[model samples]
Target: MPISTYQVKSFAFVVREGSISGAARRLGVSQSAVSQHISNLEATMGAQVLIRGRDGVALTPVGQDLFQLADEYASLDQRIEERLRGHAALDRGHLTIIANAPQPALSLIARYADGYPNVSIDFTLFDWSSAMQRLQERRVDIAVITEPAASRELYIRPITQSRYVCYARRDDDFAQRPVVHLRDVADRTLILPEPGSLTQRVVSKALADHGVVPRRLVTMTSFPVMKEAILEGVGVGLFLSASSVSERSLCEVAVPELDQVFTTCAVVPKHKLGLRVIKSFLDVLADSRA
Candidate 1:
């Protein structure tokens, strides 16, 4: 019998994740089922593909060869399925998108949800590093990030651009200023995103360059929490201009010294661009601004 796509997928997941259990968890299948798929694939191929040891599963020489074939096969499967869906005029599919910045993806997702009610989307909020790593590993179909470094391995399309802005309470002494300098807030407590976030890195570097440090520094993971703290007079917050939209109570101050502007992009593995769903979404994104 021909090896099923499920069997190949299980094998690929095992190779990608490095364990039967990891593959099972990723595929949402039982460990026994994953093992059975591997056993069947090995039998059909008449070669050992995986060696299970204390560390994890390692691909044999033959398995390494098969692994490459499996990646191509998986990519082909996605293309075929997308074509089939197109021919059937079925708008139903699952898209997994991991992003750090919520801008354009959130807007695009809203449009997609309304247009293709049958399609489901899995959007995960991840740090910048995890967002890039997952896209490189092909774990997520799409990634949205700010000012990502250039990479030939992936295809990146810019969605929008924004500049860094300072958020402070309306009644604060510096709130009415046209431009707020780092020195103005040097003595005040600062609220920012956690350490690994791109926004925090930009703000920190700008502060360090100016030799300024806040009286108190607070890092929070949730954007709403950071906004609430700023509104409640906890501390000043640095955010992208897009994040400050519709926020009437807080004052938005531009800092010319931190002249860095952020560009948000949608990144995908170049190999997976042939999928119709991905292509359609990219089209929507492109047309969105027009």
Candidate 2:
């Protein structure tokens, strides 16, 4: 009689997962059952495979060879089942996307939602620092980040360019100013984004370049909160141009002399591309902008 496929699968899973307990959890069986499966496979082959250590299992030379063979078999099985399943389901997957507050990334996600009603999306709003934190922790599956950060384990894809704009309340006295100079605020109060955000950095550098420091300042990260600060005459706001759009209450102030624009990119775990839905959404985002 041929060896059972389940036992061989169990054996392969243990080595890949690095322990009997992990394999058991993957297989939804007891840890002892996983160990028994490995033992049975070793007995059937009349050769030792896993070299058991105090803490975990390691593959021997023969075990490594068999593990590769089993991996190939599993890959083939997955492909066959997926291909046989035919049309992909439109609805029924969860997508978590993180972006700086009210940026173009939000527009992209909204466009996708309009087309695919069944697929659910969770949108997280953060300043740049917290967005990077969520990406590193895998709290968000997709991240729209500024300036395209690179990490050894992450894949970053640049999708678009953005820039900072000064915003003031539509009816405010400053709204009629043809162009506001950076030095104009030297004696006035200002509201800034959280310290670590890209907008905050831009505003800080601009002030330093002009050799004018603000006398009074308020720092907060939320887009809506910053809007309130500007409207209430707390100070001026230097924020991403894309975030201030679609609102009649705020007016954009552009300074061409500065010639500064920030880029927003998408990032995800490199190995997660193997999953179909993740790959498709990435394609859609790239296509949406193109």
Candidate 3:
């Protein structure tokens, strides 16, 4: 027998979440039920889909192949639902956005909702890793991410550039420093997003290139949290450079010879542009400020 769509969904969620418990929470199902579905899927496919351990679950090579298939299956399912709706329903519709919370993407979503108030919109925020999971699962239409999308499998496109700027408290003497080096911030505490976050990863690499890693690191989920901490004298750190005064109060310090550039992206399946709604959002994104 062929594996069912639900089983595929269960499998993909399990793989992305890295544990049966996490998958169950996402799917709104019980852990045993998720495991049973995966078991049936693996049996029907004649492959050991998942390797279970104390660390959690990981997909076998064969399971990875199915993961791609599962993504396609989800895309098709969504397209079918959209197509089945009437003309009027099509004209006024709902769009689900999944991306890093508190970024300009949220601003895009807010503007879209304001313009099309009658058309319902659901915005889902996820950290970089979970956003990838949502995009692959077709749970979201597009992801506005800070991470570069280059896997080819995920269809990464760079819509625009968002630079990384160093900022500190207004009265902090560090801001007065002429040229900031990783050496300067070496012993200072740093406010940053989690390791899985794209911005943090890029900064981490930049630090590694300079042979400097801070001993004190604070990890949070969003920029606002990190920014708040920075302003509160918790730590001095770098964040995405934007034109907003509220987001940028301190000065943009020049780091000592490193690639501090970040690209804000609209990530989706290659064929996602087939829909007018998806394409329209992308167009809006391109026209908007950096």
Top lDDT: which candidate number? 1
Q: Which ranges in model 2 have alpha carbons more than 4 Å from their true place?
A: 1-87
Model 2 worst lDDT window (10 residues): 71-80
Q: Model-by-model lDDT, in order? A: 0.80, 0.72, 0.71
Worst 10 residues of 1 by lDDT: 84-93
Please give, for residues 1-290, the per-residue lDDT of candidate 1 as tens digits.
79988999899878766689977976779999999999999999899999999999877999877776686677778688667666344366667787775666788888877777776787877767767766755667778888776788689999888888888889987688899888877898988888778878888888998999899999987456788898898888888877534677888889888777688898987877887777877877887867
lDDT for 216 (candidate 2): 87
Give the CA lDDT, 0 to 100, for residue 149 in model 2. 64
Go through the candidates in order and give the C-alpha RMSD of each one to the true structure: 4.2, 8.9, 5.1
User: How good is model 3 by TM-score?
Assistant: 0.67
> Which 10 consecutive residues of model 3 have the lowest summed lDDT?
243-252
- Candidate 3 lDDT, 1-290, residue by residue in tens: 87787798788667656689977976679999999999998888888989999999767889877777775665566466567773332466556676664666777876666655665566666678878866765556678877644655566667557666666876777878875777778888977777777768778887888888787988887776777787788888766666224534555566655445667787876756666567667666766654
- In terms of lDDT, model 1 sits at 0.80
Query: Model 3 segments beyond 4 Å from truth?
Result: 1-74, 77-92, 177-179, 213-215, 243-245, 248-251
TM-score of 2: 0.67
Using TM-score as the measure, which candidate wins?
1
- The pairs that clash in candidate 3 are none
- Candidate 1: give the clashing pairs: none
